[model samples]
Target: MTMESATDAAPLRTQTVAVKSSFYLAMRILEPARRDAMYAIYAFCRAVDDIADDEGDRAQRREALDQWRYDLDELYAGRIRPRSAFLAGPVRRFGLDRADFEAIIDGMAMDVEEDICAPDWEKLELYCDRVASAVGRLSVRAFGLVDDGAKELPTAPKLLAYHLGRALQLTNILRDLDEDAARGRLYLPREALEEAGVSNHAPHAVLANPALDQVCAPVMSRAREHFEQADLVMAGLSKNAVKAPYLMAAGYRSILDGLTARGFAPPRAPVRMSRRKLVGALLRHAFL
Candidate 1:
Protein backbone atom coordinates (compact mmCIF):
# COMPACT_ATOMS: atom_id res chain seq x y z
CA MET A 1 0.00 0.00 0.00
CA THR A 2 1.13 3.49 -0.73
CA MET A 3 1.44 6.39 1.69
CA GLU A 4 -0.91 9.35 1.54
CA SER A 5 0.21 12.39 3.45
CA ALA A 6 -2.03 13.84 6.13
CA THR A 7 -3.34 16.55 3.85
CA ASP A 8 -4.52 13.93 1.36
CA ALA A 9 -6.31 11.97 4.11
CA ALA A 10 -9.30 14.33 4.38
CA PRO A 11 -11.80 11.57 3.74
CA LEU A 12 -10.57 9.63 6.77
CA ARG A 13 -10.51 12.75 8.90
CA THR A 14 -14.12 13.52 8.04
CA GLN A 15 -15.38 9.99 8.60
CA THR A 16 -13.77 9.68 12.01
CA VAL A 17 -15.10 12.93 13.45
CA ALA A 18 -18.51 12.19 12.03
CA VAL A 19 -18.69 8.98 14.05
CA LYS A 20 -16.95 10.19 17.22
CA SER A 21 -16.21 13.83 17.79
CA SER A 22 -15.25 13.05 21.40
CA PHE A 23 -12.45 10.77 20.29
CA TYR A 24 -11.39 13.29 17.69
CA LEU A 25 -11.17 15.94 20.39
CA ALA A 26 -9.02 13.73 22.63
CA MET A 27 -6.80 12.87 19.66
CA ARG A 28 -5.91 16.52 19.14
CA ILE A 29 -3.02 16.12 21.56
CA LEU A 30 -1.12 14.37 18.77
CA GLU A 31 0.73 16.18 15.99
CA PRO A 32 -1.11 16.67 12.70
CA ALA A 33 0.48 13.70 10.91
CA ARG A 34 -0.12 11.36 13.83
CA ARG A 35 -3.64 12.77 14.27
CA ASP A 36 -4.37 12.02 10.61
CA ALA A 37 -3.13 8.49 11.04
CA MET A 38 -5.30 8.06 14.12
CA TYR A 39 -8.32 9.33 12.19
CA ALA A 40 -7.62 6.81 9.43
CA ILE A 41 -7.45 3.91 11.86
CA TYR A 42 -10.65 5.01 13.60
CA ALA A 43 -12.40 5.20 10.24
CA PHE A 44 -11.31 1.68 9.39
CA CYS A 45 -12.68 0.38 12.67
CA ARG A 46 -15.90 2.35 12.26
CA ALA A 47 -16.45 0.81 8.83
CA VAL A 48 -16.32 -2.80 10.05
CA ASP A 49 -18.33 -1.94 13.16
CA ASP A 50 -21.04 -0.42 11.00
CA ILE A 51 -21.44 -3.83 9.38
CA ALA A 52 -21.99 -5.47 12.72
CA ASP A 53 -24.40 -2.77 13.89
CA ASP A 54 -26.25 -2.33 10.61
CA GLU A 55 -30.03 -2.70 10.65
CA GLY A 56 -30.01 -4.34 7.23
CA ASP A 57 -29.82 -8.05 6.41
CA ARG A 58 -27.38 -10.07 8.47
CA ALA A 59 -26.08 -11.91 5.42
CA GLN A 60 -25.16 -8.68 3.70
CA ARG A 61 -23.39 -7.45 6.84
CA ARG A 62 -21.42 -10.69 6.99
CA GLU A 63 -20.54 -10.29 3.33
CA ALA A 64 -19.29 -6.76 3.93
CA LEU A 65 -17.15 -7.85 6.85
CA ASP A 66 -15.78 -10.68 4.74
CA GLN A 67 -14.87 -8.27 1.98
CA TRP A 68 -12.87 -6.20 4.48
CA ARG A 69 -11.15 -9.32 5.71
CA TYR A 70 -10.12 -10.05 2.13
CA ASP A 71 -8.93 -6.49 1.73
CA LEU A 72 -6.87 -6.78 4.93
CA ASP A 73 -5.24 -9.89 3.60
CA GLU A 74 -4.28 -7.93 0.53
CA LEU A 75 -2.92 -5.18 2.78
CA TYR A 76 -0.45 -7.58 4.39
CA ALA A 77 0.42 -9.34 1.16
CA GLY A 78 1.77 -6.12 -0.45
CA ARG A 79 -1.06 -6.04 -3.00
CA ILE A 80 -1.57 -2.33 -3.37
CA ARG A 81 -4.43 -2.25 -5.87
CA PRO A 82 -7.31 -3.72 -3.80
CA ARG A 83 -6.66 -1.86 -0.56
CA SER A 84 -8.97 0.91 0.63
CA ALA A 85 -7.71 4.42 0.09
CA PHE A 86 -8.38 5.58 3.68
CA LEU A 87 -7.03 2.46 5.41
CA ALA A 88 -4.07 1.91 3.12
CA GLY A 89 -2.48 5.23 3.96
CA PRO A 90 -2.36 4.84 7.74
CA VAL A 91 -1.60 1.11 7.74
CA ARG A 92 1.35 1.76 5.47
CA ARG A 93 2.48 4.99 7.13
CA PHE A 94 2.29 3.67 10.69
CA GLY A 95 3.30 0.07 9.95
CA LEU A 96 0.18 -1.12 11.82
CA ASP A 97 0.08 -4.78 12.71
CA ARG A 98 -1.90 -7.32 10.68
CA ALA A 99 -2.65 -9.30 13.84
CA ASP A 100 -4.35 -6.39 15.62
CA PHE A 101 -6.52 -5.62 12.61
CA GLU A 102 -7.41 -9.28 12.21
CA ALA A 103 -8.33 -9.59 15.87
CA ILE A 104 -10.72 -6.64 15.53
CA ILE A 105 -12.31 -8.18 12.43
CA ASP A 106 -12.60 -11.48 14.26
CA GLY A 107 -14.46 -9.70 17.02
CA MET A 108 -16.92 -8.25 14.49
CA ALA A 109 -17.40 -11.73 13.00
CA MET A 110 -18.27 -13.09 16.42
CA ASP A 111 -21.18 -10.64 16.61
CA VAL A 112 -22.41 -11.96 13.23
CA GLU A 113 -21.83 -15.63 14.07
CA GLU A 114 -23.21 -15.67 17.59
CA ASP A 115 -26.23 -14.16 19.26
CA ILE A 116 -24.83 -12.12 22.14
CA CYS A 117 -27.40 -12.63 24.82
CA ALA A 118 -27.05 -13.44 28.51
CA PRO A 119 -23.32 -14.18 28.19
CA ASP A 120 -21.21 -15.34 31.10
CA TRP A 121 -18.71 -12.92 32.56
CA GLU A 122 -15.88 -14.86 30.99
CA LYS A 123 -17.52 -14.74 27.58
CA LEU A 124 -18.01 -11.00 27.83
CA GLU A 125 -14.36 -10.56 28.79
CA LEU A 126 -13.30 -12.56 25.75
CA TYR A 127 -15.44 -10.33 23.56
CA CYS A 128 -13.96 -7.23 25.15
CA ASP A 129 -10.44 -8.57 24.66
CA ARG A 130 -11.01 -9.24 20.99
CA VAL A 131 -12.77 -5.98 20.16
CA ALA A 132 -11.62 -3.33 22.61
CA SER A 133 -8.12 -4.46 23.59
CA ALA A 134 -7.14 -5.23 20.02
CA VAL A 135 -8.26 -1.76 18.95
CA GLY A 136 -6.27 -0.32 21.85
CA ARG A 137 -3.14 -2.09 20.66
CA LEU A 138 -3.61 -0.59 17.22
CA SER A 139 -4.49 2.89 18.54
CA VAL A 140 -1.44 3.26 20.74
CA ARG A 141 0.71 2.80 17.65
CA ALA A 142 -0.86 5.91 16.15
CA PHE A 143 -0.37 7.78 19.42
CA GLY A 144 3.41 7.35 19.06
CA LEU A 145 3.80 4.48 21.48
CA VAL A 146 5.64 2.49 18.82
CA ASP A 147 9.24 3.43 18.10
CA ASP A 148 10.59 3.79 14.55
CA GLY A 149 6.95 3.67 13.32
CA ALA A 150 6.97 -0.14 13.57
CA LYS A 151 4.08 -2.53 14.22
CA GLU A 152 5.33 -3.95 17.52
CA LEU A 153 4.79 -2.29 20.89
CA PRO A 154 6.95 -2.36 23.98
CA THR A 155 5.45 -4.30 26.86
CA ALA A 156 4.36 -1.60 29.31
CA PRO A 157 2.40 0.84 27.16
CA LYS A 158 0.94 -2.09 25.25
CA LEU A 159 -0.45 -3.50 28.48
CA LEU A 160 -1.78 -0.08 29.44
CA ALA A 161 -3.47 0.29 26.09
CA TYR A 162 -5.33 -2.99 26.47
CA HIS A 163 -6.62 -2.17 29.94
CA LEU A 164 -7.61 1.37 29.01
CA GLY A 165 -9.49 -0.06 26.06
CA ARG A 166 -11.43 -2.33 28.41
CA ALA A 167 -12.27 0.57 30.68
CA LEU A 168 -13.52 2.73 27.84
CA GLN A 169 -15.50 -0.10 26.26
CA LEU A 170 -17.25 -1.02 29.49
CA THR A 171 -18.20 2.60 29.92
CA ASN A 172 -19.70 2.45 26.44
CA ILE A 173 -21.61 -0.70 27.32
CA LEU A 174 -23.00 0.86 30.44
CA ARG A 175 -24.04 3.98 28.60
CA ASP A 176 -25.66 2.00 25.79
CA LEU A 177 -27.53 -0.58 27.88
CA ASP A 178 -30.92 0.81 26.92
CA GLU A 179 -29.94 1.28 23.30
CA ASP A 180 -28.55 -2.25 23.08
CA ALA A 181 -31.67 -3.60 24.76
CA ALA A 182 -33.79 -1.94 22.09
CA ARG A 183 -31.76 -3.89 19.53
CA GLY A 184 -32.37 -7.19 21.38
CA ARG A 185 -28.90 -7.49 22.85
CA LEU A 186 -27.92 -7.63 26.50
CA TYR A 187 -24.30 -7.68 27.58
CA LEU A 188 -24.77 -8.11 31.32
CA PRO A 189 -23.92 -11.71 32.20
CA ARG A 190 -26.77 -14.12 33.03
CA GLU A 191 -25.26 -15.14 36.34
CA ALA A 192 -24.93 -11.60 37.55
CA LEU A 193 -28.40 -10.69 36.40
CA GLU A 194 -29.87 -13.75 38.09
CA GLU A 195 -28.08 -12.92 41.30
CA ALA A 196 -29.66 -9.50 41.30
CA GLY A 197 -33.22 -10.86 41.08
CA VAL A 198 -33.44 -10.56 37.35
CA SER A 199 -35.12 -13.92 36.76
CA ASN A 200 -36.20 -13.19 33.20
CA HIS A 201 -33.40 -12.67 30.68
CA ALA A 202 -35.58 -10.94 28.13
CA PRO A 203 -34.30 -7.51 27.17
CA HIS A 204 -37.46 -5.75 28.27
CA ALA A 205 -37.60 -7.69 31.50
CA VAL A 206 -34.03 -6.82 32.33
CA LEU A 207 -34.59 -3.24 31.30
CA ALA A 208 -37.56 -2.91 33.59
CA ASN A 209 -35.82 -4.48 36.56
CA PRO A 210 -35.40 -1.98 39.36
CA ALA A 211 -32.08 -3.46 40.43
CA LEU A 212 -29.97 -2.64 37.41
CA ASP A 213 -27.02 -1.43 39.45
CA GLN A 214 -27.11 -4.60 41.50
CA VAL A 215 -27.06 -6.71 38.35
CA CYS A 216 -24.39 -4.61 36.64
CA ALA A 217 -22.29 -4.13 39.78
CA PRO A 218 -19.69 -6.74 38.91
CA VAL A 219 -19.05 -5.41 35.42
CA MET A 220 -18.73 -1.87 36.70
CA SER A 221 -16.29 -3.07 39.34
CA ARG A 222 -14.25 -4.82 36.69
CA ALA A 223 -14.20 -1.70 34.56
CA ARG A 224 -12.81 0.30 37.48
CA GLU A 225 -10.12 -2.31 38.07
CA HIS A 226 -9.01 -2.07 34.47
CA PHE A 227 -8.84 1.69 34.72
CA GLU A 228 -6.72 1.35 37.83
CA GLN A 229 -4.44 -1.08 36.06
CA ALA A 230 -4.23 1.33 33.16
CA ASP A 231 -3.06 3.98 35.59
CA LEU A 232 -0.30 1.75 36.86
CA VAL A 233 0.76 0.62 33.41
CA MET A 234 0.63 4.09 31.87
CA ALA A 235 3.39 5.27 34.17
CA GLY A 236 5.83 3.75 31.71
CA LEU A 237 4.84 6.03 28.84
CA SER A 238 6.67 9.27 28.10
CA LYS A 239 4.92 12.52 29.04
CA ASN A 240 3.68 13.43 25.57
CA ALA A 241 2.50 9.92 24.77
CA VAL A 242 0.48 9.76 27.97
CA LYS A 243 -1.72 12.79 27.20
CA ALA A 244 -4.24 11.20 24.86
CA PRO A 245 -4.76 8.13 27.01
CA TYR A 246 -5.11 10.32 30.08
CA LEU A 247 -7.67 12.47 28.37
CA MET A 248 -9.59 9.41 27.26
CA ALA A 249 -9.60 7.79 30.67
CA ALA A 250 -10.58 10.95 32.49
CA GLY A 251 -13.33 11.78 30.04
CA TYR A 252 -14.80 8.30 30.15
CA ARG A 253 -14.49 8.19 33.90
CA SER A 254 -16.69 11.24 34.17
CA ILE A 255 -19.27 9.45 32.11
CA LEU A 256 -19.03 6.43 34.34
CA ASP A 257 -19.31 8.75 37.30
CA GLY A 258 -22.45 10.23 35.80
CA LEU A 259 -23.87 6.73 35.47
CA THR A 260 -23.12 6.11 39.12
CA ALA A 261 -24.74 9.37 40.07
CA ARG A 262 -27.88 8.11 38.34
CA GLY A 263 -27.74 4.94 40.47
CA PHE A 264 -26.27 3.03 37.52
CA ALA A 265 -29.66 2.78 35.88
CA PRO A 266 -29.79 3.91 32.31
CA PRO A 267 -32.26 6.76 32.00
CA ARG A 268 -34.94 6.94 29.33
CA ALA A 269 -32.82 9.56 27.62
CA PRO A 270 -29.20 9.16 26.63
CA VAL A 271 -26.61 10.67 28.95
CA ARG A 272 -24.10 13.15 27.69
CA MET A 273 -21.61 15.64 29.08
CA SER A 274 -22.00 19.21 28.08
CA ARG A 275 -19.20 20.79 26.10
CA ARG A 276 -18.24 22.92 29.07
CA LYS A 277 -17.96 19.87 31.28
CA LEU A 278 -16.06 17.95 28.65
CA VAL A 279 -13.68 20.85 28.12
CA GLY A 280 -13.11 21.09 31.86
CA ALA A 281 -12.32 17.39 32.10
CA LEU A 282 -10.02 17.64 29.09
CA LEU A 283 -8.08 20.49 30.63
CA ARG A 284 -7.64 18.69 33.93
CA HIS A 285 -6.40 15.58 32.20
CA ALA A 286 -4.11 17.43 29.78
CA PHE A 287 -2.52 19.63 32.43
CA LEU A 288 -3.20 18.31 35.90
Candidate 2:
Protein backbone atom coordinates (compact mmCIF):
# COMPACT_ATOMS: atom_id res chain seq x y z
CA MET A 1 0.00 0.00 0.00
CA THR A 2 2.91 2.35 0.56
CA MET A 3 5.75 3.43 -1.68
CA GLU A 4 9.05 4.27 0.01
CA SER A 5 10.75 7.61 -0.07
CA ALA A 6 14.41 8.41 -0.73
CA THR A 7 15.02 8.72 2.98
CA ASP A 8 13.54 5.31 3.48
CA ALA A 9 16.07 3.61 1.22
CA ALA A 10 19.43 4.27 -0.34
CA PRO A 11 18.99 6.72 -3.20
CA LEU A 12 18.69 4.86 -6.51
CA ARG A 13 21.13 7.14 -8.27
CA THR A 14 22.22 4.49 -10.73
CA GLN A 15 18.70 3.55 -11.75
CA THR A 16 17.74 7.19 -12.33
CA VAL A 17 20.70 7.86 -14.60
CA ALA A 18 20.15 4.58 -16.40
CA VAL A 19 16.96 5.71 -18.18
CA LYS A 20 18.96 7.78 -20.73
CA SER A 21 16.28 10.41 -21.29
CA SER A 22 16.96 14.07 -21.99
CA PHE A 23 15.52 14.79 -18.60
CA TYR A 24 17.85 12.19 -17.18
CA LEU A 25 20.84 13.96 -18.64
CA ALA A 26 19.57 17.37 -17.65
CA MET A 27 19.25 16.17 -14.09
CA ARG A 28 23.00 16.10 -13.93
CA ILE A 29 23.00 19.89 -14.06
CA LEU A 30 21.72 19.83 -10.53
CA GLU A 31 24.12 19.60 -7.64
CA PRO A 32 24.94 16.03 -6.61
CA ALA A 33 22.51 15.75 -3.67
CA ARG A 34 19.51 17.21 -5.48
CA ARG A 35 20.25 15.12 -8.51
CA ASP A 36 20.30 11.95 -6.46
CA ALA A 37 17.03 12.82 -4.77
CA MET A 38 15.49 13.65 -8.12
CA TYR A 39 16.30 10.13 -9.27
CA ALA A 40 13.85 8.80 -6.72
CA ILE A 41 11.05 10.93 -8.11
CA TYR A 42 11.98 10.10 -11.67
CA ALA A 43 12.16 6.41 -10.91
CA PHE A 44 8.78 6.56 -9.25
CA CYS A 45 7.30 8.32 -12.27
CA ARG A 46 8.90 5.89 -14.67
CA ALA A 47 7.48 2.94 -12.78
CA VAL A 48 3.94 4.30 -12.63
CA ASP A 49 3.92 5.43 -16.27
CA ASP A 50 5.09 2.02 -17.39
CA ILE A 51 2.37 0.44 -15.35
CA ALA A 52 -0.32 2.44 -17.14
CA ASP A 53 1.14 2.02 -20.59
CA ASP A 54 2.63 -1.43 -20.54
CA GLU A 55 0.32 -3.44 -18.30
CA GLY A 56 -2.20 -5.41 -20.34
CA ASP A 57 -4.67 -5.53 -17.49
CA ARG A 58 -6.16 -2.16 -16.66
CA ALA A 59 -7.43 -3.30 -13.27
CA GLN A 60 -3.99 -4.52 -12.30
CA ARG A 61 -2.43 -1.24 -13.33
CA ARG A 62 -5.04 0.64 -11.33
CA GLU A 63 -4.24 -1.45 -8.31
CA ALA A 64 -0.56 -0.67 -8.67
CA LEU A 65 -1.16 3.05 -8.98
CA ASP A 66 -3.47 2.97 -6.01
CA GLN A 67 -0.75 1.20 -4.08
CA TRP A 68 1.66 3.98 -5.00
CA ARG A 69 -0.80 6.50 -3.62
CA TYR A 70 -1.05 4.54 -0.44
CA ASP A 71 2.70 4.37 -0.26
CA LEU A 72 2.98 8.10 -0.77
CA ASP A 73 0.47 8.74 1.98
CA GLU A 74 2.31 6.37 4.28
CA LEU A 75 5.52 8.20 3.45
CA TYR A 76 4.03 11.39 4.82
CA ALA A 77 3.17 9.53 7.99
CA GLY A 78 6.86 8.64 8.54
CA ARG A 79 6.65 4.94 7.68
CA ILE A 80 8.87 3.97 4.77
CA ARG A 81 9.36 1.42 2.08
CA PRO A 82 12.98 0.31 2.07
CA ARG A 83 12.90 0.64 -1.74
CA SER A 84 11.33 4.08 -1.67
CA ALA A 85 13.14 5.47 1.34
CA PHE A 86 14.94 7.75 -1.06
CA LEU A 87 11.75 9.62 -1.83
CA ALA A 88 11.33 10.85 1.72
CA GLY A 89 14.47 12.90 1.40
CA PRO A 90 13.00 15.00 -1.39
CA VAL A 91 9.48 15.01 0.04
CA ARG A 92 10.69 16.53 3.27
CA ARG A 93 13.59 18.61 2.02
CA PHE A 94 12.03 20.01 -1.16
CA GLY A 95 8.47 20.20 0.06
CA LEU A 96 7.31 17.94 -2.74
CA ASP A 97 3.53 18.13 -2.50
CA ARG A 98 1.21 15.17 -2.00
CA ALA A 99 -1.56 16.57 -4.18
CA ASP A 100 0.69 16.71 -7.21
CA PHE A 101 1.58 13.03 -6.96
CA GLU A 102 -2.08 12.10 -6.60
CA ALA A 103 -2.89 14.17 -9.64
CA ILE A 104 -0.27 12.29 -11.62
CA ILE A 105 -1.83 8.97 -10.65
CA ASP A 106 -5.22 10.36 -11.61
CA GLY A 107 -3.82 11.24 -15.01
CA MET A 108 -2.43 7.74 -15.48
CA ALA A 109 -5.80 6.39 -14.41
CA MET A 110 -7.32 8.28 -17.33
CA ASP A 111 -5.22 6.23 -19.72
CA VAL A 112 -6.44 2.97 -18.19
CA GLU A 113 -10.08 3.80 -18.71
CA GLU A 114 -11.89 1.95 -21.49
CA ASP A 115 -12.69 5.31 -23.02
CA ILE A 116 -9.33 6.91 -23.57
CA CYS A 117 -11.16 9.14 -26.01
CA ALA A 118 -10.04 12.69 -26.25
CA PRO A 119 -12.60 14.86 -24.57
CA ASP A 120 -12.92 18.62 -25.06
CA TRP A 121 -9.92 20.93 -25.10
CA GLU A 122 -10.38 21.78 -21.43
CA LYS A 123 -10.31 18.15 -20.43
CA LEU A 124 -7.21 17.48 -22.47
CA GLU A 125 -5.47 20.43 -20.84
CA LEU A 126 -6.47 19.12 -17.46
CA TYR A 127 -4.95 15.79 -18.41
CA CYS A 128 -1.70 17.54 -19.26
CA ASP A 129 -1.85 19.36 -15.94
CA ARG A 130 -2.07 16.10 -14.07
CA VAL A 131 0.36 13.92 -15.97
CA ALA A 132 2.99 16.51 -16.91
CA SER A 133 2.63 19.67 -14.87
CA ALA A 134 2.31 17.77 -11.63
CA VAL A 135 5.68 16.18 -12.29
CA GLY A 136 7.08 19.52 -13.38
CA ARG A 137 5.94 21.12 -10.17
CA LEU A 138 7.81 18.50 -8.20
CA SER A 139 10.90 18.80 -10.38
CA VAL A 140 11.02 22.58 -10.12
CA ARG A 141 10.76 22.40 -6.39
CA ALA A 142 13.58 19.87 -6.21
CA PHE A 143 15.81 22.24 -8.22
CA GLY A 144 15.01 25.06 -5.80
CA LEU A 145 13.47 27.24 -8.52
CA VAL A 146 10.68 28.58 -6.36
CA ASP A 147 12.72 31.18 -4.50
CA ASP A 148 15.17 33.79 -5.72
CA GLY A 149 15.66 35.74 -2.52
CA ALA A 150 11.86 35.75 -2.34
CA LYS A 151 11.84 38.52 -4.95
CA GLU A 152 8.88 36.98 -6.72
CA LEU A 153 5.90 35.13 -5.34
CA PRO A 154 6.26 31.42 -4.63
CA THR A 155 4.07 30.69 -7.60
CA ALA A 156 6.82 31.56 -10.08
CA PRO A 157 8.33 28.08 -10.36
CA LYS A 158 4.87 26.55 -10.64
CA LEU A 159 4.03 28.91 -13.48
CA LEU A 160 7.23 27.97 -15.24
CA ALA A 161 6.57 24.30 -14.64
CA TYR A 162 2.94 24.40 -15.76
CA HIS A 163 3.58 26.18 -19.06
CA LEU A 164 6.62 24.12 -19.93
CA GLY A 165 4.80 20.95 -18.96
CA ARG A 166 1.83 21.85 -21.12
CA ALA A 167 4.11 22.67 -24.03
CA LEU A 168 5.91 19.36 -23.66
CA GLN A 169 2.70 17.34 -23.32
CA LEU A 170 1.08 19.03 -26.31
CA THR A 171 4.17 18.41 -28.40
CA ASN A 172 4.11 14.80 -27.26
CA ILE A 173 0.49 14.52 -28.35
CA LEU A 174 1.38 15.82 -31.79
CA ARG A 175 4.43 13.65 -32.14
CA ASP A 176 2.67 10.48 -30.98
CA LEU A 177 -0.68 11.02 -32.71
CA ASP A 178 -0.45 8.06 -35.03
CA GLU A 179 0.99 5.72 -32.44
CA ASP A 180 -1.49 6.72 -29.79
CA ALA A 181 -4.37 6.47 -32.19
CA ALA A 182 -3.28 2.98 -33.09
CA ARG A 183 -3.32 2.14 -29.42
CA GLY A 184 -6.85 3.53 -29.07
CA ARG A 185 -5.50 6.47 -27.18
CA LEU A 186 -6.06 9.82 -28.87
CA TYR A 187 -5.06 12.79 -26.75
CA LEU A 188 -6.21 15.33 -29.31
CA PRO A 189 -9.50 17.03 -28.83
CA ARG A 190 -12.43 15.44 -30.64
CA GLU A 191 -13.54 18.93 -31.52
CA ALA A 192 -10.30 19.53 -33.38
CA LEU A 193 -10.63 16.27 -35.31
CA GLU A 194 -14.29 16.95 -36.14
CA GLU A 195 -13.49 20.47 -37.25
CA ALA A 196 -10.78 19.05 -39.46
CA GLY A 197 -13.52 16.97 -41.20
CA VAL A 198 -12.62 13.63 -39.65
CA SER A 199 -15.63 11.83 -38.19
CA ASN A 200 -14.17 8.50 -37.11
CA HIS A 201 -11.78 8.07 -34.22
CA ALA A 202 -9.69 5.34 -35.79
CA PRO A 203 -5.94 5.98 -35.68
CA HIS A 204 -5.29 4.81 -39.20
CA ALA A 205 -8.21 6.81 -40.50
CA VAL A 206 -7.00 9.90 -38.69
CA LEU A 207 -3.53 9.50 -40.11
CA ALA A 208 -4.79 8.84 -43.60
CA ASN A 209 -7.26 11.68 -43.50
CA PRO A 210 -6.22 14.67 -45.56
CA ALA A 211 -7.50 16.88 -42.78
CA LEU A 212 -4.91 15.52 -40.33
CA ASP A 213 -2.77 18.58 -40.79
CA GLN A 214 -5.70 20.88 -40.22
CA VAL A 215 -6.74 19.13 -37.05
CA CYS A 216 -3.16 19.22 -35.83
CA ALA A 217 -2.65 22.90 -36.57
CA PRO A 218 -4.33 24.19 -33.43
CA VAL A 219 -2.52 21.66 -31.26
CA MET A 220 0.75 22.81 -32.73
CA SER A 221 -0.14 26.45 -32.21
CA ARG A 222 -1.10 25.86 -28.61
CA ALA A 223 2.18 24.06 -27.94
CA ARG A 224 4.14 27.01 -29.27
CA GLU A 225 2.11 29.38 -27.16
CA HIS A 226 2.79 27.36 -24.04
CA PHE A 227 6.48 27.30 -24.86
CA GLU A 228 6.47 31.07 -25.05
CA GLN A 229 4.70 31.32 -21.73
CA ALA A 230 7.32 29.04 -20.20
CA ASP A 231 9.98 31.31 -21.60
CA LEU A 232 8.36 34.28 -19.91
CA VAL A 233 8.46 32.62 -16.50
CA MET A 234 11.92 31.24 -17.04
CA ALA A 235 13.12 34.76 -17.76
CA GLY A 236 12.00 35.83 -14.28
CA LEU A 237 13.73 32.99 -12.46
CA SER A 238 17.38 32.86 -11.41
CA LYS A 239 19.90 31.16 -13.66
CA ASN A 240 20.89 28.26 -11.39
CA ALA A 241 17.46 26.71 -11.00
CA VAL A 242 16.44 27.49 -14.56
CA LYS A 243 19.33 25.68 -16.24
CA ALA A 244 18.06 22.12 -15.81
CA PRO A 245 14.54 22.98 -16.92
CA TYR A 246 15.82 25.08 -19.78
CA LEU A 247 17.99 22.30 -21.07
CA MET A 248 15.19 19.77 -20.68
CA ALA A 249 12.73 22.06 -22.47
CA ALA A 250 15.19 22.63 -25.30
CA GLY A 251 15.43 18.89 -25.85
CA TYR A 252 11.65 18.48 -25.89
CA ARG A 253 11.12 21.58 -28.02
CA SER A 254 13.42 20.15 -30.62
CA ILE A 255 10.94 17.28 -30.98
CA LEU A 256 8.16 19.77 -31.61
CA ASP A 257 10.31 21.51 -34.17
CA GLY A 258 11.12 18.18 -35.78
CA LEU A 259 7.43 17.30 -36.01
CA THR A 260 6.65 20.66 -37.52
CA ALA A 261 9.46 20.29 -40.02
CA ARG A 262 8.04 16.95 -41.15
CA GLY A 263 4.51 18.35 -41.41
CA PHE A 264 3.52 16.52 -38.22
CA ALA A 265 4.20 13.26 -39.99
CA PRO A 266 2.22 10.18 -39.04
CA PRO A 267 3.37 7.21 -36.96
CA ARG A 268 5.42 5.76 -39.80
CA ALA A 269 8.52 6.97 -37.97
CA PRO A 270 8.46 9.13 -34.90
CA VAL A 271 9.80 12.66 -35.15
CA ARG A 272 12.78 12.48 -32.86
CA MET A 273 16.04 14.41 -32.79
CA SER A 274 19.32 12.56 -32.88
CA ARG A 275 21.24 11.81 -29.69
CA ARG A 276 23.91 14.13 -30.91
CA LYS A 277 21.44 16.97 -31.24
CA LEU A 278 20.00 16.39 -27.79
CA VAL A 279 23.38 15.97 -26.19
CA GLY A 280 24.66 19.03 -28.00
CA ALA A 281 21.80 21.06 -26.62
CA LEU A 282 22.55 19.76 -23.13
CA LEU A 283 26.19 20.75 -23.35
CA ARG A 284 25.31 24.09 -24.92
CA HIS A 285 22.66 25.01 -22.35
CA ALA A 286 23.72 23.21 -19.18
CA PHE A 287 26.19 25.90 -18.27
CA LEU A 288 24.33 28.87 -19.66
lDDT of 2 at 191: 91
TM-scores, all models, native as reference: 0.90, 0.89
- Candidate 2 lDDT by residue in tens digits, 123-166: 99889999999889888877887542232327788788789989
- Model 1 lDDT at residue 122: 86
- The deviation in Å at residue 151 for candidate 2 is 17
In terms of lDDT, model 2 sits at 0.76
lDDT of 1 by residue, 77-175 (tens): 666443356666667767788788888888888787755888988888888888889888888887877874664688986898779989988888888
Model 2 RMSD in angstroms: 3.2
Top model by TM-score, which number? 1
What's the C-alpha lDDT at position 12 in model 1?
53
Off by over 4 Å in 1: 1-7, 10-19, 81-83, 149-151, 264-267, 274-277, 285-288
